[model samples]
Target: MDTIASLFSFITTPVSWIIVQFHKLYGAIFGPDTGWAWGLSIVSLVVVIRICLIPLFVKQIKSMRNMQALQPKMKAIQERYKNDRQRQSEEMMKLYKDTGTNPLSSCLPILAQSPFFFALYHVLSKIASGDTIGVLNQELVNSAREAHIFGAPIAAKFMDSEEKVAALSASLTDVRVVTAIMIVLMSASQFYTQRQLMQKNVDLTVKTPYMQQQKMLMYIFPLIFAVTGINFPVGVLVYWLTTNVWTMGQQMYVINQNPTPGSKAQDNYLQRLLKSVSSHGEVRGRRRRSVVQAIVAKGADRNDNERKFFAGLAKAGFAAQADGTVIKSDTVTADAEAGSAARRQQPKRQSKAQRQSGGTHQTGEAKPSLEKQQDTPPKPAGKSSPATPRQAKSGQRKGSQRPKHPSSKK
Candidate 1:
């Protein structure tokens, strides 16, 4: 027993030293007589330890996610090798190894912190028994002896009592009450964290062994804490309670920001994001409609094509605006119109005679001929001439002669 105690004391020395240093620091700030300072020092120790274990926490999350992802394949393997336990175990281990994930990695953070918990537990236990152990000097020992949280000693246990009956009864009562409260709080925090993961963050569709294990642990951890809390020193209880709170908050943050896929929390987050985007789009659409209305009210005579385009935008939940146009641009439309106008302005092809005479007619502008107009002598009443001066100038002859008047018929 002595050898074991010595080994425990040696292992706990560093943890006790850190706690004492923090206690001193808090004592300086809040004054030496404040019991809450020492209590807070234990909490600070938990914070320091948990902070150092962040990498393990990350690994745990990654391993759990990998396990969740591999659930289907794992189920298939189990189904195929139901009669062959040895082969099934080998296959499962092979799968885990190939994926670079250890099924036990999820327990690493808690397992790593167990030694520190035991160290603090041993240090506080020695102080409660009035012995200065390990790195706890006489000053820290005196402070530990004096520290009381709500009249309950920091190193006190629920079953510990003084020699005198009156003192024993009061001390036991105080210790029991405080321990009960701390146990409930610590157990509740742990339970709540697990509940959140199962209810909000875990995929219900997956009935894998890992998820089942998590559910089982949910009940087991709280029961364990409730059962064991009475034996823990007040300072150790404080450390555990604070760590529980930290874990709950961390789980909440993960559930809110990066919830497990196909989970209730993920669905809720996606729904919220979609609603926000849709609301923003509606507001922008309204603004665009107002702008388009303003442009139309200003009597901008938009062409049929422009009107059709704006109507299409409206139909597609988009709106046109003077500043924020939502359709094919006015510049492009203007360029097309300008091209059509240029085509209309081009001159038409001239006739062969006009080309030979070098008398081209510009578009919508005709030039007069250089030849003078001549009147033929009035035809005799009985004349039947077949050619006219115009036809003669063109070197052409009429095929039929004009008929004589009826008076010349005889």
Candidate 2:
């Protein structure tokens, strides 16, 4: 731990300077030597660092989602080159390159924060050893050493000896209990954050190794924290716990607002959107409009949740347009009802009497006449009527032809 901290020694001065600045602000209200002053300083430092890492966090999210989407292609490449390790590596790189994905992007926030973490660790370690480092002069160091957070000195560790804890004006039992509770809280917070992410935000429809890896990390991360937490000072634990809570809250906001397309978060989001749009008869906000626009752009490719959303809109007599606006569509509903009514209507059946009479039923409706007299002039008394010239050329009669007796066929 010392070696690692030394590797980031250059950052210790800046980290200590920031903490001292925050301590000055908090110390005035909470007392310069109180736990709240020092503990909140650490927390403030974490907030400042995390806020600066927001861009990296966003890139991490994009990278993780992109990795999930590329799993099938990655799996295919692995299978095709199962026997060729070098070629498989090449193809994997090609896939990542073409997709503009960096597998390491997901680690950017952690990597970016590590220097500060180690620098803080080093500073606290020095305070524990009664040494002044960075901008923490002897007077500030002495005050920090005397700062007790919930009966435990800020620089005390769970593994600290009784003598060391006594020297810091705290009992061993008090220090151990405080540190234990903090460690447990930190680990639990970490676990819950990852679990929330896996359960609500991940796209479960795609079976991928990326999901498996995430699940593994869900368990692994908390365990790692719990194991390493014993070595962390009480102040470091506070820093980690505060950061974990911040991360959880940030993730919840993202999952609620702009979740993955096929995730449960999206389903819930769309349901809420459906209710809002149905109540107001329009999309309410620019963010919601963008969401609707994307879903509309998906068209037939939309998932079940999105399809249900569209159906709900239609049921409310609202139609979503390509530009993400909803409009009342009374004509669409009326046309649908009219078509259904037409399908349900059957033609009136003709009775045998009506068919035989070839005239109207008792109703007053008129039927067309099949013939007025025959177009021909009255034939001479004894002369047989010759076939019409048009009929002769056509080789058949036009209207109904009489059937000849079978035995008298020509």
Top of the candidates by lDDT? 2
Clashes of each: 0, 0
CA-RMSD of model 2: 5.6
lDDT, model 2, position 162: 93
Q: Scored by CA lDDT, what does every candidate get?
A: 0.73, 0.88
For model 2, how does the per-residue alpha-carbon lDDT over 316-364 read when each residue is reduced to its tens digit? 8889988888999997688777888998896688888788767785584
**Which candidate gets the maximum TM-score versus the true structure?**
2
Residue-level lDDT of model 1, residues 93-167, one tens digit each, is 899989987888867888888778877888877776667877888777777777888778887777565542133
Residue 331 CA error for candidate 2 (Å)?
A: 2.7
TM-score of each: 0.65, 0.83
Residue pair clashes in candidate 2: none
Off by over 4 Å in 2: 71-90, 335-410
